[model samples]
Target: MSLKRRSFLKGAAGGGAALATAAVVSAPAQARPNKVMPPQAVGLLYDSTLCVGCKACVAGCKEANDLPVDVSTPDALWDTPLDIGPKTFNVIKVYAEGTADTKDQEKNGFAFIKKSCMHCVDPSCVSVCPVTAMTKHPQTGIVEYNADACIGCRYCVASCPFGVPQSEFDTPTPKIMKCEMCKHRQAEGKIPMCAEVCPTGATIFGPIPALTEEINRRKAMKAGEANVFERRVIGSGDTHERPAAKYLDHVYGEKEVAGTQFRHMSAVSFTKLGYPELREQSYSSQSEGIQHSLYQGMIAPVVVLGGLVWAAKRASHIEDEHPEE
Candidate 1:
C-alpha cells in the first residue's frame, strides 16, 4: 500500500514536470515584432507651441460626445476638470517653471499639452481585454470601446500606457470610457470636434501619412519663422499664421510603442509634459506573441493534459492492484 501511494505521488510530480517542460519548449525564441500602422489610418497632430490653454477643445469634445460637465471646483460654476476622466475625454495640462512668464521656454516659462487617447497602432488595451470590448478599426485605426461587451474587468485600464481609459467607479453601473476620435462626426463628413473648434490650429486631424509630412515640415522650419498651419482637417485650407517656436527634435508617439495615431510636437520636453518614455516595441506584441506561441492550435495545453491523464490512469491501476489494505 505504501509503495502504491508513492507511485501515485511520483506520477503526479512527473506529469507536472512534463507540463512545465512542454510550456517552455512551446515558447518562441523571441517576442513578436510590432504591428505596422493601417494603410488608411487617420489621426491627430497636437502642436503644443500653438496651443493657448483655452480648453476650447475640451468643451468641444464634451459637446460632441454628449458628455456631462465634470466640475472639480468648489463653486461648480464652471466645468474645470484637472485631467481626463469619465466625463472629460480631453484636457489641456500646463507645465510651468519659475515665473512662468514665457510660453514655450522651459526655464521660466509655461507650456500646454493636450491629454487624450493616443490610439496606439498596437494597443495594449485591445490585447488585454478578455472580451472583445476594446477594438481597433482596421481601416481608420481608431481605438473604440464597446460598453456592452465590457465585463468590468478593468484590464484595459491597467494596460493603457497613457492612462487614457477611465472607469466609472462612482456609478452603480460602471463603464470604461475614453476618446474614440469622433467617428460619428467623420461619418457625417465632419472632422473631430476638438480640431474643428480649435482657433489656433493647435490640434489638427488628418491621415497619418500626411501628418507625418506636416511634422517633418514643422521640424525643418527655423525658430520664430512665420508659418501657415492648417486647421480642422489637413487640407481644409482653413489656415492660421503664427511664428513657430523652437520645437524639440523628437516627435512624441511617432515610434514609441511601435507608434500611435495621435502625435504631439512640443517646444518643452515631452517628459516634462507627463509623457512616458517607451521603447519601439509594444507591450501587447511581446505578451501576445508568447501567449499565441504557447497556445497555438491548443498544442501545448493538449500535450500537458494528455500527460496528466496518462499519469492519472497509471495511478488508478496501481491503486486497484493494491486495494486499500
Candidate 2:
C-alpha cells in the first residue's frame, strides 16, 4: 500500500474499533428473547399434488385485495400474468417435464405450484422496512403492509428472498403488496380470500401448530390413501374428499429461510416449482448484529471528531512556527 493509504488505514483502525465498542456498550441490556409461536398463526398450506392450476385462488386474491388486472398480451384484455407482479399478488406456476403425463411426478409429469408470500416467521421484509410500513402482527403472526406509512423505498421488495413483495411502478403514489392472511377477513372470523374460494382445498390456512400436525399426518400416509383435507381455514368448518399423492418425503417451508408461517407440502420438488433454496440463518440476524456492533448511537463518532479537531489544531500550530511566506 502507498504511504498515505497506510497512514489513513492506521488512523481509521482506532476510530472503527472505538465506534464498535461504543455501539455494543450502548445497546439495551433488556432485549427480550424471541418467543416461540404456537401452531396458530394463520397461513397457507398448499398441497401441490391436489392443485389443478385452475387459477381460482389468483382471481379471488385480486378481487379481494383490490389489485388491478394484469394484461400480459397487448391484444388480450383479461388479466393473466405469467408470474407474480404488483397487480397480481398470487400466482400458480407450472412445472412441465418430458411428456408431462402424470401429475406431481418429477419425470415425464406436470405439477402446478402456488407462488405468493411465504409469510416468513423471520421475514426479511419486515426487518428491513425503514418506516415500519411492513410489520408482523404479534399475535396472529401475519405480516401486513400499510401503504400510508410507506415512503415508496421498496426495500421490502428487494430484501425478500422469495420475491413476494412487489412495487407499483405504474403509479406515482405506489405501495408494496403481498399476502397478509386477510387480516380484515380474520377480524370477522372469516378465512383468507384465496383459501375461502379455493376449490381444491389445496391452499388451506390454519395456525402453524395445527397445520404442521396435519402435514406430518399426510406425509406418513401412502399414495392413493383416502384423506379428507379442509379447505379455507383448517377447522373453519369446511372439508373435501381426496386421495394423497406420493410426496417426496419433505415439506418446503418447514425449514427453508428460517421457517415460514406459510408451509408447503409438495409431491414434486420445491426447486421444480420455482421455490429457491435459501439458508436457514436469517439475513436479518446477521445484518442487525453487524450494524449494532459498528454504530450504536454516535458515541464513537463524537470521539473521532475530537481526535480530528486535535490533529487540525496541532497542524496549525506547526505551520505558525514554520512561517511559510
Candidate 3:
C-alpha cells in the first residue's frame, strides 16, 4: 500500500479497535444491578379502600404547595383537574364500573385512586435527568425537583413509569411539577398535607418499615371486619375505626420497579385503579447499566477520540513526507 493510503487505513483500524475495546469493557458494567431503597426512607401508604374521594387531600396539597388552579374544562370555574399536572400535584382519579353502586367493589361499583409521584426507590426520573434537577433524598427517599437546576427538558416526564413529573406548558418560564411528599412540612415538624388532611387514613405517611408492617397487618385482615387504622402518620396516636374492605392480594409499588417509597393498597385490582403494571426490576437498572458500561469513567470516548487524533496525526505526517502529492 502507498504510504498515505497505509496511514489512513492505520487510523481507521486504530479507531475501530478502540471502539471494539470500549464495547467489550462496557458490556459487563451495563449488567450492574439496580439500586435499593434507603434504610430510613419515609413515604406514603395510600389505602384505596379507606378513601372517600372527598378531595380534601387535593385541596390541602394545593394550599401547601401554593400551586395555582387547574381549570380542566372551559366552563368549569373550579380547579378541578382530571389528573396530576403542573397545577395539580395530587389528584383523585375515579374508576367506575356498571351501575357504580358500591365503593371499592370492582363490578358495578366506583373506586377512587390517588395519582402522584411514586417516589421510586430507584427513580427513572433521577436516573434520566442530564442535569441534577431530579434528586432523591438519602434519608427520606423523597424524589424532589429543583427548577433552578432544570433546563426545561422533559426527560423526567418521559422516564417516569407512573407518569408523575409534569411540565408546565402554559407558562413562559415552565417548570416540572410533582409531589415531594411534603418534605417541607416535615422539616417544620409537620406531616404531608395530603396525609394530614386525610380523614379516613387513606393516605398515611411514615417510615417505610412501619408502613410495611401496617401493610402486612391490613393485608391479613379479614374482609368486612372492623379494624382500627392509624391516621395521618404512624405512631401519631391518632386512630380511626372502620370496616376493612376485601383487599387484593397484591400491594402496588411494594416490589414494582424495585419498589417505591409511596406504597398502595386497594380492594380492587391495581390495574382497575389506573396503575400501570410494572415489573419488579427498575428500568434505571438496565439504562444505567448500559450508561455506566459505556461511560463509567469517560474512558471509552476518550480512548476513541485519542485513536482518531493519532490516526489524523499519522495521516498529516504522511502528507508532509510526500510534499503534497
Candidate 4:
C-alpha cells in the first residue's frame, strides 16, 4: 500500500495498456511482401554444363576488382585460391561423385559450380545492415558495398543466404568483400570480366529479361543437342557451338528468397553444388515486417520510455515525502 508500490503498479499497468494499444493498431499488419526485381535489372546466367573447369573467370574477377592475389600454394608462383575470400571474389568449385568420369552426371561424374554473390532482389545484407554501406542499385539491382560507410559490423556477412560476403579479419581496417557484378565495367558499356573471359560461355551477363529468355531457350533444348551458346553478353555476335548437357528441371534463383539477379542452371542438382534450398519469401521481408509492426511511428518505444520516467520521478517524490519508508 506504499506510494512507491502503488506508483510502480500504475506504471506497469500503463505500459501494458500502451503496448496493447500498439498491438491493436498493428493487428492488420502482414509481413512485407518480397521486393520485385528492378526495372532494368542486370544479372548473370551461369550454366555449369558449359563450364570447362577453367579459372579464367576467377582471374578476371580479381583483376577487374583490383584485389590482391590469394597465393595458397607453398611455391607462391601462381594465384591459387581454393575458395572465395577477401582477396578473391569469384571461385569455381567442383563436385565429384565416384570416379568422376562423366561431367554433369550425379553418379560417377564431376561438375563445376561458380561461386559469388547472388545479388538478391531482396538482399538480406542490405536489409540487415545498420549502416547504409550495403545497397542494392535501383536500376541495376547490383548489391554494392561502400567501405567508407561500413562500421565493420559484419551483419551483411551473416545475413547473406549464399554466404557470399566475406570479411577481411586479418587487416587492421577490414572490409566486407563480395562480387558487385563488375558494375564499373558495366558503366563503360562492357560486361563483367568473368563473362568476358569465359571461353565456354558458362557465365554470361545481361539484362534480367534477356537472361530469362536465354534460360528458357536452353531449358527447351533437347539433351545432347548441338547448340550455339552466346558468350559474354546477350545479343553479342560472339558465340560458340557446343552440345548441351541434360539440364535439371529447376532454375535456381528464380524464386529462392523472392529471386536473385544471378541465375544458375546445371545438370547437377543445386544442393549437390552447395546451394541451400530457400523459401520464396525473403527473410528480410518477414523480419522487417515484424519490426515495423512493433515500432511503427516509434510510438511504442516512446510510450514505454515515458512510463519508466514517470515511475522513476514518482519514486523520488515518495522517498522525499517519507524519509524512513
Sort every candidate by TM-score, greatest first.
1, 4, 3, 2
Candidate 2, residues 202-238: lDDT per residue as tens digits? Answer: 8888878778888988888888988887777777667
Number of residue pairs clashing in candidate 3, backbone atoms closer than 3 angstroms, sequence gap of 3 or more or interchain: 1
Q: What digit string (tens of lDDT, one per residue) describes model 4 on residues 41-88?
A: 999999999999989999889889999889999999999898888999
Candidate 2 colliding pairs, count: 5
lDDT of 1 by residue, 1-325 (tens): 3555678687888799878877776756367889889989999999999999888999999999999989998899988889998989999999999999999989999999999999999999999999989999999999999999999999999999999999998898999989999999999989899999999989999999999999999999899889998888899998878888899999999999999999999999999999999999999999998788878888898889888988777877767777864
Tally clashes: model 1. 0
On TM-score, the stronger of 1 and 3 is 1
Worst 10 residues of 3 by lDDT: 23-32
Candidate 3, 134-181: lDDT as tens digits: 999887889998999999989999999888999999889999999998
Candidate 3 achieves a global lDDT of 0.89
Colliding residue pairs in candidate 2: 39-207, 39-208, 39-209, 40-207, 40-208
lDDT at position 295, candidate 4: 82
Estimate the lDDT of model 4.
0.90
> What TM-score would candidate 1 get against the native?
0.90
Task: Provide the lDDT at 276 for model 1.
Answer: 92
Residue 221, candidate 3: C-alpha displacement in angstroms: 0.7
lDDT (C-alpha) at residue 145 in model 1: 93
lDDT of each: 0.92, 0.79, 0.89, 0.90
Q: Candidate 3 regions off by >4 Å?
A: 1-26, 302-325
Worst 10 residues of 4 by lDDT: 21-30
Query: TM-score of predicted model 3?
Result: 0.87
